[model samples]
Target: MKHKHAEPLYIKINSIDNVAIVVNNEGLPAGTVFSDGLTLIEHVPQGHKVALHDILQGQPIIRYGEVIGYAMIDIKQGSWINEAVTKMPTAPQLHELPIATNVPEPLEPLDGYTFEGYRNADGSVGTRNLLGITMSVNCVSGVVEHVAKLIERDLLPKYQNVDGVVALTHLYGCGVAIDAPAAIVPIRSIHNLAKNPNFGGEIMVISLGCEKFQPERLLKGTADTIPIKLESVDDIVTLQDEHGFKAMVDHIMRVAERHLIRLNGRQRETVPASELVVGMQCGGSDAFSGVTSNPSVGFASDLLVRCGATVMFSEVTEVRDGIHLLTPRAANQDVGQALIREMQWYDDYLAAGKVDRSANTTPGNKKGGLNNIVEKAMGSIAKSGRSAIVEVLSPGQRPTKRGLIFAATPASDFVCGAQQVVSGITVQVFTTGRGTPYGLAMVPVIKMSSRNIVAEQWFDLIDISAGDIAIGQATIDDIGWRLFKLILAVASGKKPWSDHWGLHNPLAIFNPAPVT
Candidate 1:
């Protein structure tokens, strides 16, 4: 079913593009004529591309002025070009990627911007003063979860200044091959999750004493750098050590109160916006993602970089097709090569799993007019803006430098969000077109809608709308500045819609290691 627009409008990203997407609410019907006098011979869904010219079999279909795909058959000038008709193009060869060849001149510094934040003893800033109780083994997740609930209900009311408590539980700890070569990733990720800035330096781990991943191994070298165990591992709570569940709950409650007292004593102080570590990601994205929300995020990302804040953009498969565009924007050869290495590692990892980047796009993505990952990659990288990628990190690794960074992680929404939290994002800006209730318990997730319809329909869920850029209502710069202010406000203790409703999915740690 197709709907006709009174004024048939289509969005063409670039002059060189051979296709333009329909902009009508339900998409334009067949025989619809645009102001440019181009008649659509077939119905094209909103955000779905229309072939601007007759395409021959094997001819490239150009969108974003890049070869997103090739025609599977001879196509009409005005037909809807979809996944059924298009063949995805080959990804760029990693070996031949340009390194720092197109770095832009630095943006003018954005100074004097500040946020109210909780300052930690490790020189980190917390957007929330939370007591994050974690565990080395999933065997104790149930008890830790039980303890976190009790802490929230019984203890949190007494500590009014504390934001909340989180049970940082995951399925990675016990069963898998903990001694595998790649096991270090999820291991280090678990260790660093205890040190996230939002935790306010009161880190505690609940361990199942018999588990292979012991308490000592989890806390081995983190004491000096992070504000963790300077004394001994005696502070770690062990489930097996307790006599009963009641005893376990009571012991955890006692320890939680101590941490909550310390956390409650903490107050927000005015800190420069440069202390902000913002992670940008997109999920349930569509073609409008690149056209609107992602570009707006990219704009804000540049502003954050100018203000000396650390920003990260991830999802390796989402950026794989656009790696050529990103390599040249790297700060130097080392950063560029690091990006390639991560890409290559993921490529190998996927190969081992008998899949490829094509598996990254979801059914919702294709339904929302994303034909393939190649096109989605073009849209996904827009969140990084034009800032030079200063650093590249493996999944769950923390950042050592500021500015823009490429944190290589899987494109799964939950996995990316969890890894970003481990990488130290105080706030996250997530954009979507298919609309999701994807929130993070570890950090505040600001949801931005990629289309006006989603914004209107999910009004209570969406904090901001970049959909205006799709219409003539606003420019990317306009939304960018607005998003920047929103980031500052959210970081300064204002709750985004996700946090307001307390809607968050459990943290999904990226464990590429074996499950034996």
Candidate 2:
């Protein structure tokens, strides 16, 4: 397995898909003959299709060997099927899928792997180290950002070891119901920032003191840094508030001075692959994500898993429709039961909210030809690869089991990335079909554009353009190996393409279950 290489490839999603995904992008025309060593299907344009044989109106259209949709009206033995013109037949009645009962074999561990990471005081390892500044609410977000930016530009350049200064921000903190919250963005954001491997000490939390995020709770949750401190300013004096900001800024400078020794000494050390947790996420997906970037990431993730590393896969609603296909081999009965329970819990929880998990796709996904959550999820879930399900955890909970850890987070890309950070992902592999520039604070997002056009258009945001897959230039397996080594370089302290281009730094927390 490798992340970097060049070769043509195709993936058989299901035995029925007459068209396999084109890993190599060129030379094949709509009428060109295609073969998978089993069946000879005709070639169509990327994201389009070719017929396996003469078809009837009721016959299903297969790709990846599974039913993506059905032919509306068809008769040709060798004709191209355009996704735009395709329509699915009436839904086939579904029965309950049988649950697997037996414990599966322990998967083969990944081999010959090592990464440079920091050993935190908590015994957990981090991929990067930084002195972070946290905002208590959106009201003072600008102040926090100003203070952190000053440190990043002025102070960080002086410190050889510290990664840099990051100020984590969000859209909520006041004027909203803290309980029964519409979104627990602030808390989740802070929690995620604190958990990200990049931070090495207690962050300076700036607040006006009356916000929803009480200072005590925030401090209590974050007490690992050497010296924890807080500054609560009085809101009564408008003139005095300006003075307070200056005084607080001075205090942070002093606080920053205090942590300089520890921050400066932080260095990367050789760590086992087991200590690594990679976030698997996809956004701006198109027809190519499932076939190229998604599966390439999956194969890369499998390599990491075999080397004893953990990969966190999110976007439950998209993939919930295929739990049978997505569930990895579990370590034991306990692990397997946990995996099943997690899926069932999502079904019940969303139902309680009067929201069906199946309706989770965004407008962008629909515009790109995905009609429902099932199709989107089946494609997105491909990033996790085949591995054992070691544990299932809620957002912010650290993964104790190795291999694949299923983090229960919303399907939205940013929200899932935030939760993955809280679950201890040191770095992330983000696959996009259309294009997205989003990145999480503290965690380095490695963006891979699935199509050549999107990659060329958004080269600044996409770190790895998988356009080669669509152009018939590289096999997903070859790209998988390329990605694997690039990730190791990332773990070794190479800045992700996102960080190099200054693309992300937002935080979010999940507050599932009502706060009574």
lDDT leader:
1
| Superposition-based RMSD of candidate 1 using all C-alpha atoms, in angstroms | 1.8
TM-score of 1: 0.98
**TM-score per model over all chains:** 0.98, 0.81
Question: How far is 259's C-alpha from truth in model 2 (Å)?
Answer: 2.7
- Candidate that scores best on TM-score: 1
Q: Candidate 2: which stretches are off by over 4 Å?
A: 1-13, 19-45, 70-97, 100-104, 179-189, 220-243, 333-337, 340-372, 452-461, 465-473, 508-516
CA lDDT of every candidate: 0.90, 0.66
Q: State the weakest 10-residue window (summed lDDT) of model 2.
A: 231-240
Residue-pair clashes per candidate: 0, 35
Predicted candidate 1 versus true structure: per-residue lDDT over 269-330, tens digit per residue: 99999999999999999989999999999999999999999999999999999999999999
